[model samples]
Target chain A: EDKVVQSPLSLVVHEGDTVTLNCSYEVTNFRSLLWYKQEKKAPTFLFMLTSSGIEKKSGRLSSILDKKELFSILNITATQTGDSAVYLCAVGKSNTGKLIFGQGTTLQVKP
Target chain B: DVKVTQSSRYLVKRTGEKVFLECVQDMDHENMFWYRQDPGLGLRLIYFSYDVKMKEKGDIPEGYSVSREKKERFSLILESASTNQTSMYLCASSPTVSEQYFGPGTRLTVT
Candidate 1:
């Protein structure tokens, strides 16, 4: 069965502290991995990684995938209160382009 | 910009009542998906459509049915609303399976 797991289900950190969120997935015919940040309502796209090793970054957030290890990590630097949200990871299959998502990590940035 | 819109931000329904959730995507994406978000379960796929009138059962399709009469619209139906079905419903769309854009989500409460 295809499954996605995330580590550190919840985290609380100071405003300036950096945090790392992990996601590992097992699925047939891996195509891509995606990251999303959900604040109070909807989720916004963060990053999409298809190749291994190469990193995708936007502002203070960056992510990378390791297909060989069947895992991915999201790194956030210079965190702020606005960055407090639920981070979600989803793995897409090549055969049908369907995705399987993880439980997500809740990060709270304290001032 | 990819804009996925849900019909409501919040809804309340009585137990055993039939419920319908509507979603529309502006982008001419080929894939549309419906998912429910819970506290610890993250987002679980309920149904998806690759094209008009072509529906596929997702990981959690029980007790739910979907309609995709047009390319830009997808609707989820709950034959009988239950307390356990109260959740945040999310709608997403993608050109393919790579990156999905999500709606603001509808918070449904059943009594």
Candidate 2:
């Protein structure tokens, strides 16, 4: 079975602090890795990383995939209270639209 | 923008009752999926359909069934609502092997 694990299940940081959340996975025919942010309702897409070493960024959030290491990391720079949410990492397999998601890292940013 | 819509935001049902959760996507995607989200479980796929009338079991398919009568709509049915089935249900759709668009989840509570 494909599995994705995330590190530091929960983190607390003050505003302007930087946080890095980790996700590692084991799957066959790996395709892409996706990041999402969930506050109260549904999760919103953050970034999608396909190639190793190449980083995908959006404002204060950036993510990179290390295929060789079978892991990915999501970085939030200059965090704000609005960034407090559950950050989820999901892996998609080749030729299938199915996604295996990590347990998610809960980030709490205090002002 | 792609839009995924769920029928309800919150639902409460008695044990043994038959419950149905509806989901619809407006992007005319060929693949639709149903997932349940829990505190520590992230997202567990219940079932998915690649085409109309085509269904496949996912990682956690027990106690859940799905229907894809139309290309744009997928419905998840719980044969008998149980306390263990209480969770936030999410629906997603994708065109191919791309990132999925998710609906605002439906929170179900079984009493």
Candidate 3:
């Protein structure tokens, strides 16, 4: 049974604050991990990590995966009200292209 | 840019009625997926298609059916709409077994 769990189900932060969202997974033949941010209508892709230790970053968002530990973390720096959304983490299977997703972390950035 | 589109953004259906959700991708991706999003359950895979006319059941496929008549279109059908089936349905497509591009999503309400 593949399972993905995320910590800090909800968080409240102020402008310029930094936040870290954690994701842990237990799956067979783990191939990749992905992050997404959902505002209102849809979720936008953030980062995809396959290798352990190496980090992927965008303008103010970054993520890293640790295959050995079976976990991944997404960090958002200089948070703004625009960053308020539900962050989702998902793990993909190598052979089937199937994905198992976590419950997600809801972050509300205050002005 | 990969553009995944859903047939509806919001839909309301009565109990025991049949419902259909359509998805299309312009990128001609090899794989397409259907998932349901809930408040605390995250996104649960309902079904997926690797190619035209080839469908596979995901973690939860009960009471749902899928169709992939064309390479770029995938449809999810509910045999009988129930109140418990009300959710946000997401459609995604991928070129390979990697990062998937998602559609804006359809919010379905069953009364």
Candidate 4:
């Protein structure tokens, strides 16, 4: 079965701390991997990585994919209380619009 | 900006009752998806539609049905709600087979 696994199911960090979350997948015909942040109501898009080695970044968040290892990682630097939320990772299959997601890492950023 | 909206934020229904969760997107996306999120289980795909009236079952589609009568709307139906079906139902839309935009989600409680 196509599955995505995320490590450190939960993380507690202080403000300004840096945290790295991991995601690994076993799927048929891997295409792309995506990250999302869920705060209150919905989950917002973070990044989508299709190629390996290259990294994608926004403000304080960055992510990279490793196709050879069948995994990906999302790094958040300078964490704040606002960054306390569940981070989700998903893998998409080639030619399929469907996505398989991991359990997510619930991050708690203390002030 | 792409906007996906769910009809409800929280809903309470009794077992054996029929339930409907509606999702609408403003970006005129070609794909729509329905997923259930649970603690430890992550997000499990229930169903998806690539185009209007074209539906495909995902990993878990038992006891569930979907409708996509128009381009912007997708509906998930529970013919007979059960306690196991209580979960956070998420709706998402995508332009192609890539990045997806999600809605606020609907928390369904079956009693």
Over the full model, what C-alpha lDDT does candidate 4 score relative to the true structure?
A: 0.95
Root-mean-square deviation of candidate 4: 0.8
Residue-by-residue lDDT tens digits, candidate 1, B1-111: 889999999999999999999999998899999999999998999999999999999989999999999999999999999999999999999897668889999999999
DockQ per candidate, 2 decimals: 0.84, 0.88, 0.78, 0.87
Candidate 4 CAPRI classification by DockQ: high
A-chain TM-score, model 2: 0.98
The runs of at least 3 residues in candidate 4 whose Cα sits more than 4 Å from the true structure, single-residue gaps closed, are none
Q: Which regions of candidate 2 deviate over 4 angstroms?
A: none
lDDT string for model 2 (B1-111, tens) is 999999999999999999999999999999999999998888999999999999999988999899999999999999999999999999999999989899999999999
lDDT per residue (tens digit) for residues A29-97 in model 3: 898999999999678889899999999999999999999999999999999999999999999888877
The local lDDT score (0 to 100) that residue B93 gets in candidate 1 is 92
Sliding window of 10 residues with minimal summed lDDT for model 2 chain A: A41-50
Judging by TM-score, tell me the better candidate of 2 and 4: 2
Fnat values, one per model, are 0.85, 0.82, 0.70, 0.82
For model 2, how big is the iRMS in angstroms?
0.6
DockQ of 2: 0.88
Model 4's DockQ? 0.87
In candidate 1, stretches whose alpha carbon ends up further than 4 angstroms from where it belongs are: none
